[model samples]
Target: MDSQLHIFFFPYMAHSHMMPAIEMAKLFASRGCKASIVSTPANAPHIHKAIESGTNLGLEIGVLSIRFPTQEVGLPEGCENANSLTSLEMMNKFFTAVNMLDQPLEQLLMEHRPSCLVADLFFPWATDVSAKFGIPRLVFHGFSFFALCALASLLRHEPHKQVSSDSEPFVIPNLPDEIKITRNQLPDYMKEETEFSGFLKKLDESELNSYGIIVNSYYELEPAYADHYRNVLGMKAWHVGPTFLCNEEKEGYKAVRGQEASISEQECSNWLDSKKSNSVIYVCFGSLANFVDSQLMEIAMGLEASGKQFIWVVKKGKHEEGVKEEWLPEGFEKRMEGKGLIVRGWAPQLLILQHQAVGAFVTHCGWNSTLESVCAGVPMVTWPVSAEQFYNEKLVTQVLGIGVGVGAKKWARLTGDSVNREAIEKAVNLIMEGKEAEEMRSRSKALGVMASRAVQEGGSSYEDLTALIEDLRLQRHCCGSK
Candidate 1:
């Protein structure tokens, strides 16, 4: 009773992973626990800016850094983060650099010896590293319960193999819902055996050996999958999110949650104010996704054909192979001058989605983006590109009924999906108007309200976080050293 509990949060070097981990750390810090975020030198600066408010309030929180082996691993200087990669071929060396952090991270643990380490799934060795110091390691998967459960079921039952073709949809057995997925939609780890797939195996093993999981989700968001993951899969877990709701709504707070805005929030707001409620569509893939000029053209033409007001978030691709395909048709901007706003970089996504004039979203179905759309009461046209996004698309289109799929059939980070403008236009039109669209909007709004309440005092997320912190404290008392 004479001491404070200190918790260390170590997130993967990605925006989605670090942002939520920072929020969760602040949540713990706000509730009277000493929290510190662990990152490599490059990633540590992001934490500094985000935790300023918490530190200013005299909350027990700060940042810690680990040395990344850049030269030894053949990666460029300051290339510790995943977003720094210009091409997929560079992943091998980047991953090797990440793997080399094991020793430095362990050295830090020996020095600080925090009560618990809430580590991201990227570090499969985190479990063993924390165990060396008798510290509890909580795995932050940063995904929805439904997506996790669906993956678990797929792993348990190789239903994808039962189908003859990669595109054939097969029902994953024993899930809470009758979820159907194709082999092509699965992550490379799930599709077939490879070096990365073996790494994924290690990640799964590490998670199993860890103390428990801390998800960025709430019970109301996917109650069935929550129960299924706990009761059926039997993993020790706790849900303490929609964690972004922890921050008090201040001016431009939402705009800069994940990253700095390329365009001013006021400028985006003025554009939104010009349109009526439920009229505009916002489209964005997350930071790590891109497409060839052909796919980009399809999207541009689709938005043009939808004949609706829209805001599209895009990034300048680092012209690989010295061939920069034209992403837009001739005079496309002139045609969309008033009807659309093309934000050619990191736009304030949460800001745009939560606005009254924004009705539907066209998203790549990243967990952060999907959950943000859920919180904003906006339905989606799901176009999952890579990672677990395809599975998330299933959850949205099938189980949740809050989104429609754009018939994206492949899974790749930098993509050229055969999903042409017609498919894009059809899905956009379906989710933007008519009785079905209204019903989807109503369901989304109800879920958004539930998400809000879940983070309030005495709500499910509130209590879960309270319990999680207390549980960590008790575990430290039993197992940790001073």
Candidate 2:
């Protein structure tokens, strides 16, 4: 076995995708592996900072930046990541730019010849590229085992095909758990034949041939789904996460768009200090989530009605003009004065969740957000907006019993359907003070303890990480001998 096994990581450009991979790289480096992460120039700063933090802790993690083919893809310069792109058309161009990196990535791998490659699922060609250099490629899903298993089952059975209407509910076939999903909740790629569907099909096939997968979850959190992915799906996989917990400070990586501009960290912390322990609700959607003006008004009214001490991070809406004051319900801010704190742009989510005053989270149920909530031991009021969030909502509300949904029956970007103030108020009540909320809070606290333990020495995720490093070393040796 190599004395210092070298592992290269390639993450998709989105913040949610890149952050986990960055943390995973730091984890590998902390375990005495030489870890390198590759990203476009525009996205490299955050990765570099994360690696620098790892280096401060004596981890051998480095960042390599490549020039994104912006002009070739007809995209504006610096439109390298998913969050930076403005429209679906630009998104398509971004994918094209990502695909164009195949040749450069192949050249980079061949020259460096790392022991293993950890890549995002978006890069189907990574398996082949790694194989060309005789290195194992482990696909990273950036999702929970539960969401992965459910989506895989749906793909295999195509149960949504039987439903004639988008509103019709259909039971996902061949799943270990009985889960019902409406047709509209399905991702756009899965609901109809599209170019992205073809891309995903290829990605799935590539994963089958790759070495295995590495998921950002822990064994105690989803033991059944982990087993199903291993035994039922017949894949070699490792669970070595809640990866963000690996960072000692847990200050959160600097986002590509930068930090929250609305309030100072000290001000936010001081505000929380004034509140009782577990008495505040923290509301934030992931980076990509946007709401219409009408929905924003509904949310403003709902939070006022909940009567709970809350801190809400409100990113500017797509249709918003001038100031956010125009988007909110008239006189809403004045009416709620001391009851709520609204921070515009990116809030320090990890920091906020870690605060003692935060009791529950109102989240879009993104995998990263969900895991963060769990690690914080905070219950949730789930409002799933898009992508795999709906499935993640199920994991929170039904499977884990640590969350209550806001009755979001359909999926839409920002325009389709609005969850009124009434539903939001009800969900908030359920998570904040309902009889069931007490039980959920207890369960959440227990799970948070488990999550924290899993990443520590002699824990499940810790052991898995050790095993993965050893296995990769052995595989490297085998390849070298051959």
Candidate 3:
């Protein structure tokens, strides 16, 4: 402990991975550990802002840069932007970059000689590199503890064997709660055999085999799943999440893009402000979740039926083919007039979620959005599009009991035989403004308090983080002398 304990951190190129890693770095700095983060040159600006924010608050965190091919293989330049490309394409490109990252990352490790490394999902190769350098590796899963368990179960069973690819309820054998998954709801990439599934499989296995694992979750939020990690997986893991606690002064904090509108911010927030408070339904399927026009029309009609003020952020190419607002209820916009704002581009989500007028969120239930909604003290209408979202929907509706999930019973689009427009309208109504809605809102507020407390000093997350740092340093030293 004489010299600063150097800890190297590397998050996957996507924003979801990078944000949690940055928060973890802040925690390390707060506890007197020196953090050196690694990322591609394109990602450097993001890390720079995160480091700048931490340094401004007297946290000691440094960043190291790595070079990635601007367009590796088939990925285009700036294809790593999470807000743009599909998740599968991003994964293929990202892991391709990971394979190439070893040498430069190795060079940094040799030069810095950090006590340990914290790596994100999708970098299973980190284990090999850590072994080479004799440094302990801690893998971070940026999703729910439940999702981790579900994923583990999927990998263990390899369910593609039991049911025909064309069948329904595609049961994942030997998991609790009769956990049934469908083909369409499986992660977009996992729908077929390809590089994406292989990459994810490697990440899952690497995480299970890592020296230690850390999740951006809390015991209170996911006690049972945390127990599963400890008893079943036999991995020393830490659940420290709702990282929003790091943002004490919510106001004046810059959006992740760092700029107001040019090139990144995209004027999304200014449009949101023009709508009425609690009257607008904010819809974002997250950085991923492409939609066909028919599905998009269903959503638009559902929102229209609610007749509530609304602000919608539609991703590029989300609408169904040949579909437009012409399919929307006639006179809808004219009726709502100044009440609705729809931006067909990138949205300043954190800012929008935190806005006082914003009452509810319709999100894909990504951990980032889950935590952000809690931090903003806003209720959510969970519309988990795919992957672990089914588990997340469970947490939102069954476990937390604070939010309404459109896909609580099923994970596919509403158009399928499973659910239709009536069901969609009903779920939306129950969540947006209905008899049970206020009680759900109250419950969400209560959970927000618990979420905040988990990240504060002496809280579960704080204690777990401390334990992780101590254990990591000790393990790294023991491995070094061997």
Candidate 4:
């Protein structure tokens, strides 16, 4: 194996999953390595954009397609294409499909004969695939270290013992940080002894104990978790992240719409452009979070009463038909005609957040979204909707002190499913106009600068990336003696 080499990368089949892998791929390719982005055919359209961007920029990057079972075991024909499913459900199906992928992945490895395989944590067979070819395997956890640490902790417990509803913080053993979380905040599968829990636990144990684990977080923000993985867990792990900064050259690039017009990207920029500087409250719950009728109504009423200019990017079909403005106060849209911008489909999130007019983010607190918010130097109102989002909320509100949460503890709703209009107004007002908001804004901006520095030439994340490559080089050399 050569230090200057080709590598294969597999991102789990989701936009959030794909973006992080693409970010890392760009980084590796820019560093004189060729990268083949191994993914399913369904993810081609979205990932093709990323692949094209990397290759056209003169980085050696290519797309390698994987096969999906003709009949999905637990989903509809086009379930993978639909963005409506919850992240937990998505992961459940995705991990189940991993068994089907082994053949295709193995074939690609034999054909490409890459130096290493850098794959998403969902795919347990990546380590086996690397070993078969005598190559190093780097398992990338495309999330914050906190979530990775949580997953590692979840793996140590028996499947039957994991679902206990004790009203106490389940402390993660052997971690440097006392990041204690309640049972309610655990991954959805671990909350109960369902089929999903048993299957997921098996996958975690197999992958978590791999030769190396790579997390999408910088050392400074998660020094404790990073240190734990390296020291206590005694695993070869790398924290090369604040991943967006991996390519400053690609910062200005936008997604080019080719064929699938399912997601529209029109006038979203103009809408953000019209809002007041640092005055618009941008709300998006990522691609997966779906709200029930009552929750939807409550959120609408809240945004209406807040009286601040807002850009609410509602997902398509999130709520029932005829409930768009019907759920809000009468004439609310008319009242805030120039002030409110409701983009119902995909909006350019990074561009919108990075805009000068966008002030506070009313977010679902997904790790990728959380990191993007922090990197954009925007303070947040963390309205965590599901899964590991609650833990992310804890990190933002408690550990980082850079955002406000909608709940008191893990999974506790600030208001019931149907929050009254007044509570919404107050939450928005607090984040947008209060002294606390300004303090968070200042701290978030400072952290953004630090995050940027972390990926720079001599920065923490940069050195980590360099170290990972150097270690792989050493591992390859050592293998010759065997």
| lDDT winner | 1
Tens-place lDDT per residue, model 1, 417-466, is 57889999999999998999999999999999999999999999999988
Q: All candidates' TM-scores?
A: 0.96, 0.95, 0.85, 0.88
In candidate 4, the residue pairs with backbone N, CA or C atoms under 3 Å apart (3 or more residues apart, or in different chains) clash, namely: none
lDDT of 1 at 427: 94
Candidate 4 overall lDDT versus native: 0.72
- Model 3 TM-score (2 dp): 0.85
**How are the candidates ranked when ordered by TM-score, highest leading?**
1, 2, 4, 3
Question: Candidate 3, residues 341-433: lDDT per residue as tens digits?
Answer: 666656667777766677788877878888777667677787776557776776777766768866544344322223345656777678768
Best by TM-score: 1
**Cα lDDT, model 4, residue 196:** 65
In candidate 2, where is summed lDDT lowest over 10 consecutive residues?
251-260
In lDDT terms, how accurate is model 3? 0.70
Off by over 4 Å in 2: 250-262, 317-324, 413-417
Question: Candidates ranked by lDDT, best first?
Answer: 1, 2, 4, 3
Tens digits of lDDT, candidate 4, 1-482: 34577778887777777787887888888778888898877777678776665244678888888767636657555555435355556655755665678789989899888877888777777788778879788887676777766566666753325535645666666555566667655554666578867667656765655668877888877677777667776667887787766654463454331123233445667776766789998888877775554665677778877778888876655445755544455676688788887766666677777788989998888888898888888988887766568767777887788887665344532221234556667778888886888998988888888889999999998898888877766776787668
> Could you tell me how far off, in angstroms, the CA of residue 430 lies in candidate 2 after the best superposition?
1.1
lDDT, residue 128, candidate 2: 90
